[model samples]
Target: MTVIDLVAQADGADPLETEPLYHAIDPDLLDSLPDADGFSRLEFSYQGYTVSVTDGTDGVEISLAETGVSVDGSSGDLIDTEFST
Candidate 1:
């Protein structure tokens, strides 16, 4: 499945005690991400609600407060957490 699809499915769940599903993707491939910049505005299903990753100058960030599943970016890291739904 595509990254978006995987993220959407994972996000649609209860936030309480939900463990963040980590998906490590190649950074090189991320450079070709189609909606990289637009992802911030796109909401995905998270904890029975729609949430979006906020794209910052450095990179993308996703946080499920209750679940403690925070996804962040790293510079030049070979393996990076792509999404947490």
Candidate 2:
């Protein structure tokens, strides 16, 4: 799952360079995410990208790890809620 998540946004050639999931999220949260609902928004950073998994967003959202940068690199916060997952 971690590799899938990393590769989903990684530069492909360097996806393996991303940090392991264990270093990105807590084990407890990671363990419970598979059962998480869309009502919940869980986010974290892997390597230099942001990873977001919302209850109903279908899948995770990954982007460059920059402040005030939206998924499209617009001038707004990509995520409104703090990291809770």
Candidate 3:
């Protein structure tokens, strides 16, 4: 999923090598949220990042919260988390 992809990207590793997204949130619930009438956003922590998914008229936007540590155990900084699909 996007969270795993982003985390893997930040770590400079293959997405498959990253932790499973389901470990941080319910994948099935997340997949079904767009169909929920009033659903707009969801946030959860994966690895060392806080993942935020916002639903809008344009599309779903994914972002990561700034943290003090990264997946590689270094200082964390915000990456390009503002993307829609």
Candidate 4:
């Protein structure tokens, strides 16, 4: 999937005022396949906040470095944490 796709998935969790800067693995490597089937990390710059998402076999983790907060979820509500800059 493209970076935009990751961002879209994340954004769908909640409506936020922060703008997102999306980045993803290059989508042009037709001959190449990732070692993993899911996303490893998704990061974006919203307003001044840097948000990141990491997925593991067991679950997904979301973090906001600027707020020094993080959330981990396997399935359920979207975890929201606010870091203190």
Candidate 5:
């Protein structure tokens, strides 16, 4: 999935109806992904989710607001911690 599709899934909205990706990253940033030489990655928060795009990958990853939960998981905190410091 493209970054835009992941953002749409994260927001529970239509891809076209969601905020344009241009609002989050420069349009050219995406255009350059195809020519990555090494481990190129882009990260940004949009529509309440943390988005991660890695070069040479066909999928876009989305996580919930960086609150210790992944979008596709249906469980408690994935990180085990009793204290927040």
Candidate 6:
């Protein structure tokens, strides 16, 4: 949900109006993944961008592929919040 929300935010679209998340990945499998020691991570494409979910350590994180700018799911704050022209 956090992942979808942030991507929608970046795209200036409503979360509900954006592409369905399940079309890119399985929500159940995502939820079932372990979050121990920050080793568990999942990367998939959604809404034309690569979405990465990293659990544990610093909580859930979602980033735009290799953009370096990432959203911290727990805080809803952008990390490395910069964009190149």
Against the true structure, whose lDDT is highest?
3
By lDDT, the better pick of 2 and 3 is 3
Cα lDDT tens digits for candidate 4, 8-73: 444454334323333222334311333447557666554333556566445555455332233231
Candidate 2 per-residue lDDT, tens place, 1-85, comes to: 5534444444455555555667767756755765766446666765445666655455443333334553455676443332321
lDDT of 1 by residue, 1-85 (tens): 2333544545563444343433233434443444554554444444332344466666654432223333442223232324553
- In order, the Cα lDDT scores of the candidates are 0.42, 0.52, 0.74, 0.41, 0.55, 0.62
Question: For candidate 5, lDDT tens digit of each residue in 1-85?
Answer: 3666655665568888877777777868666666756646676755445555655345433333443544455444534222110
Q: Model 2, 81: alpha-carbon shift in Å? A: 20
TM-score of 3: 0.74
For candidate 2, what is the lDDT?
Answer: 0.52
Q: Is candidate 3 or 5 superior in TM-score? A: 3
TM-score of 6: 0.63
Clashing residue pair totals per candidate (backbone < 3 A): 2, 3, 0, 3, 0, 0
Q: Is candidate 5 or candidate 6 better by TM-score?
A: 6
What would the TM-scores of all predictions be? 0.28, 0.47, 0.74, 0.34, 0.55, 0.63
Stretches of candidate 4 off by over 4 Å are 1-36, 67-85
TM-score of predicted structure 1: 0.28
| Model 3 steric clash pairs | none
Of 1 and 3, which scores higher on TM-score?
Answer: 3
Clash pairs detected, candidate 6: none
For model 6, what is the C-alpha lDDT against the true structure? 0.62
Deviation in angstroms for 12 in model 4? 21
Model 5 accuracy (lDDT, Cα): 0.55
Model 5 steric clash pairs: none
